[model samples]
Target: MRKSPAAKAWTRCAVSGIAAAVALSASLSGCGLPAADPGNPGRPVAAAAAAGSQGAAGNPAAVTAGSRVLNPANGRLEAVVPEVSRTVLLIGDSQSEPVDGWPRLGLAAAGYNVYFCGRGGTGFVSSNGATGNYIDALLRGDWLLPSGTPALIVIQGGGNDAAGAASDRQITANAERLIAELRERYPSTPMAMIGTLARGEAHGGGRRTEVDALLGSVAASHALPFVSVGDWLTRYGLAKDLADTVHMNPAGRQKLGVLLEGRLRDLGLDRKPTADQQPLRASGTRDDGPGQD
Candidate 1:
């Protein structure tokens, strides 16, 4: 409809106000979160690139530790069997709560073929409250073990599950079903259930014990290794070490990476690089393509 100049001006003003409000809402939603730092890499083992950098020149321990952490031999888990052949599948929420620089750092340092299959707000329970189809979609999708049978499957989720309207039994059952499917699909693969970390004061005391018990029982029933972050948080004082209620800071991520590195090693799932090998990250796809579940 035709409008006078004054009316047109008012319409423009209203549109601009709406845009401003939308932008402000987005900004507010991102509060209390660490902006993704590709530089941080979140690897428990230091990166080789960083090793030659000025930082590592001064601190040689960083490089040595990186090699040690990545060296499958140094991983002393008796159950691991220390094999050079293995790949990793990382499934979790934002608070799968990795240790330092993550995905880039931790996966790289560990030298495993890591497929990070985590989506924000998706959890073992709720299935996004029956409306969200992340899990079912993932199962039908093709996000896991691209290199073939992964020696280990690391399910690092449950934070969102706890918050979801679904019952604890439902969450635990879903997780168990997932593990059972993995076992059926890849019988040789060992499943590792990494429990969610404790949120600091913001969550009114984290690590829902009810959920923990459920996860533990399911993991035990399946004979899968269960690593609880609850002990780490209690031992380390989560409030002091955590960056926030859920996510960990750089130091926290690193510490968590160290713990996972050990766990992965014990599973005999850590891989080593060969002289002729090229780094996977140099050619890795940020998107593993499409979901399969």
Candidate 2:
């Protein structure tokens, strides 16, 4: 009643194949880029282009997505979610990691689902149509919510656009376009755009200040509530809080989330900062108001 040698060899081979397949599946699922649904067939967005944009010259190496820092080479940390949940789509550099993005923890603490769309090295200006400027991609991809509307959309970006190579006016203009596009797409969704965090020697001290001012102007022009994390960094004193001259560490991200919760509440996105946030500010700007040209 003994099995043949050939039979035993086949069994081992089958088990090895199954194990390999399982491991591959697990890896993909964890990354949150599962293959497109079979029943409802359509092409998924161009992930290659998205990946390239994150790696473009002078961009950050990582991005915060959901509750993880996404490595472009490997989508690492893209799918993992913290226990408490409510989605906040982030758009920014490594400075916006889920733990660093703060809104993920803040909104989740207040009971909401959060998703991180943190794209490293992304800017408001089009990368020559490469990644479709964050706002344009959001609208085209319907990034608001699964129901086509989200409770809140938090944007943190533009640090790269603050380059000396580009005039302050140019940076400001690009940011304005970003805000305008978002307004046109998701008119009623409450949005909060964060200013850059810390300044570095790259722009000299003054250029950083100019960047913050231009960002503030964009928020005001759109009438969307703004959170000046850059200003907050100055007020809080940078040396101790920052992990580096530029980005913050995990502890820093937690502080940011706590501060941002209040801003969302003030803008009427959340009721009391301790409870579920409600959408307060109308989604679209004056120009893109409901049914208005």
Highest TM-score, which number?
2
Which ranges of candidate 1 are over 4 A from the true structure?
1-85, 96-111, 127-134, 142-147, 199-207, 266-293
Candidate 2 — worst ten consecutive residues by lDDT sum?
Answer: 284-293
Query: For residues 1-293, could you state the per-residue lDDT of candidate 1 as single tens digits?
Result: 88986466445434433332332211101101122222355742234333333344577444321122122222211111112244455665555312222332344345554444544556675343222323553454422223235545677656666655557678867876788766765567666777656543344544454455567777888887776654456555545666555566655554555555556567654565578754331002222111111
lDDT of each residue in 185-247, candidate 2, tens digit only: 456766777776644334344555566666777888878677765566655444466665555
> Candidate 1: TM-score?
0.55
